[model samples]
Target: MDDLTGGGAPDSTGAPLLDVFMQGTTFFDMVLTGLPSQPVPGTEIHAEGMGSCPGGIANLAIAASRLGLRTGLASTFGDDVYGDFLWRTLEQEGVDLTRSQRVADWHSPVTVSLAVHRDRAMVTHAHSSPVPLAGLVSDTPITRIGFVSLDEEPEPWVSRAKAKGAKLFGDVGWDPSGRWAPEELTGLGDLHAFLPNSTEAMAYTRTEDPRAALMSLAELVPVVVVTCGGQGSIGIDSLTSEEEWVPSLPVNAVDATGAGDVFDAAFILGTLREWPLRNRMAFGNLCAALSVQQVGGSLAAPGWGDLADWLAGVRHAAAAGSRSAAVLANSYGFVADELPSHPAVSLRRAVATIARMSDA
Candidate 1:
């Protein structure tokens, strides 16, 4: 991993790469403890701690900057202590937050993250949900940044950016019917690329299979990119004759937070370079593979140089690992939900099925 602060790393071709600018919000993380177990009712949990950085749009900006683009983060925050920390962290990540502002007496958005083994639970308080800015667009001269991602909220500049021929992209995080205030969420159609995870896709389309959900989503958007943890990911590239499937890279798993975000960033990079679907998927898989090796989200993200080097070295073993991931994804999704129900779901049964396939 490279320094969290600004630093340069030479790419495979031997050139120094630096952080770029991007704009977005600073989150107030209220992460909880007691992972690998369900939350007990009436249990008292603490904020535990807090960290600051450009999240959402800001995260995408920091990643783009790290890969050597001058990225800028434009978002809103209150004049609270956390807001101040957010600005500093963005600067540290080399994200240009010049356009972001500190509103007086406004509270920043906060989310409580809970871990239950491989699954994660989050409860959010979006205090700055109704962020309003006079000038939300930028006239600043930024180089060709074809990739853009949004966590939530709509920036009119995004549409203008697309009109200027910049590639616009984003992930539809999630909007639960029963719980979430769905009106606050935005519809995901009309994007150069629309990335959504299995959960979100299912919720939107009301389907269990990822393929069916993606196909349904394609009616609204040209390209529907769906991210599945172990199954890797797939996207419909209409530019080509048919859809493309990108396989996942194998890794010793740990934390799953930010894996989807990392994958989205990698996909954008691969698309900008016009890599083949396979290579694009490989880049995303490798990015995700490295992410789970460490704890937390951003901390686990590998520097581009380190990741490229790592990929260059792995060969057939990696492919086999991907097949393993596919087998798991196909049989039981990415989670271990079968063990408790021996009648249908069990890792042992899944393994036996896999063994039979291999043996045959």
Candidate 2:
């Protein structure tokens, strides 16, 4: 395999010779931080800080690209300022947008998030895309992996990508209907991996224990991972008959808006690299832990540069006789060998507001 951070040159049509291909909605996310508490209705409150970025599936796209994956995104963008900002930001981050489109009169989706006490509350406004998913994936590119959301029935693109030999990874959103029907997971049989939080896993599998849920899902999908918030994550690889549980790292969380997405991206990277299942879980947990220490969603994703800096800090602390840092260094020792010698410069970071390229 090529270097972990290396990517193939784009084709003549500008489509990325991809490592990951994804199709989903992209939202303009405005995040408010340092709120003392959730605001009461009919009251005025002030936020201490704020950030803006492309959110929704863009979170995973940016996270994957920043990790040096040749990533392609297919989503509908509005012709408004928010859409313009998102398009430029993703392009600057090196994510290929050849499969995406911007509509003339459609308005961009918007999400306003309030970050408080290490958690967040959000309000979103969006409309159905003017273009359909079939339209976007009609000519899917060959890729190493495809990330998608699981639904009751698999989409045509899902079959197309699967037929092309792309290993599919699936995630699911909250079931607002509260039905949690078994039929909803029928697509699991077609996936290489399924990642869901503890609640969603239990709900779908009818198992109260996260491990049991993991086992149940593993029967269908080759790889199953259930994330249990602060407790960490549990995984079962039916192909290897390997079951592992990795604990979450201790970190001061600032905003958890896209931590899950970050974890998914990192895990996908590890899977593509064919790391041990335990290492993949640990790497995912570490990336998610680091992401929560910052604000914004997509921009807050940690690049190789961030990973290098973190490793340096841990080593320094370990040398100074810090037990916690020593333990952390030991747990993440695998990264020392995996990281590129020269990490990329000019990585994206969370900013208070969107600015012109010249101003940035």
Candidate 3:
């Protein structure tokens, strides 16, 4: 097992088992916001907001870590400047990358996201050497759960991880081939949960209705969640044969880059905490909604501090006992109590709120 203290720094050796072990790619994302208009051949337009951070799997890992989940990320990083920055950023977010590989002389993956009023256009460039999923799975520590994508086969490692008592959660990307065949989920029966967007689920299951897609997918996995942007999310817990829906929170979006990934991270955290299916969906939706209000993918992901502040603000606003307040308090009862605070966390929340207001 790799050392938990990445740099050999002294810390608690009795720390809990990794809550969510993940295998995927990480990127250094450059965020350019307030682009007055899309770029033209020779037009030069400066952005009002600029920021950079680690993205992709880093979004999921850092989001989970910020939500108080102990996370481990397994992937290859380059030995370049972007790599250094990304590595440091993930470390600062408290993600364990001890099992991650670093390639010499390789440039880290990078993405330039141009934010244009609640939407974005991203251009990404990755090294020719693809992320070795097989190697990452082999390097994962025995954790409560593991996360991966279905872009590759989950063969021996996924099954092996399950046999060792780790729950496997999976996600999928859009298929340009339009094959979207159900057979693509051949060996995924071992997955504890499968979270796919509405379009992906409908396409894969060949069902026009999201509910039908959820029910059909529940037969293949223990848990199936279909995220419907704006409309909300629908999920079914096969073990209990219970189905639930959670509406998306109302929020002004600035950039919707990694909202889905942040939702996945929040779901993983809720699952680890043994929250009810409804609570999990609502929490996940809240986290994703909060993410889009910020700029960069990873930077936009809300931490526990953000969650606390949001809940506090919601509670304080709901003090008048309005119907909406009553409903929100009842739904988020799990987080209604007081929470610990720190100076850094407060500062982060203050800055994020100011940015969102300015963006509006």
Best by lDDT: 2
Model 1 ranges off by over 4 Å? 1-24, 30-34, 42-54, 129-135, 138-153, 179-189, 312-360
Candidates by TM-score, descending order: 2, 3, 1
Which lDDT tens digits does candidate 2 get at residues 222-307? 99989987899999988888899999988988889888899999999999989889999999998898888888988889988789
TM-score quality measure for candidate 1: 0.70
Best by TM-score: 2
Q: Which 10 consecutive residues of model 2 have the lowest summed lDDT?
A: 1-10
Q: Per model, state how many residue pairs clash.
A: 17, 0, 0
Q: Which parts of model 3 have CA positions greater than 4 angstroms off?
A: 1-16, 36-46, 136-140, 337-360
Q: What Cα-based lDDT does every candidate model obtain?
A: 0.55, 0.87, 0.76
lDDT of 2 at 205: 92
C-alpha displacement of 162 in model 3, angstroms? Answer: 0.8
- Estimate, for each residue in 266-329, the C-alpha lDDT of model 3 and write its tens digit: 8887776677798789888989999988877877888767777788777877896667866787
Report the Cα lDDT for residue 241, model 1: 40
lDDT tens digits by residue: candidate 1, 245-327? 76666666655666776776666666666666555666667677776654555534566455444534453334567654454
**Runs of candidate 2 exceeding 4 Å displacement:** 4-14, 357-360
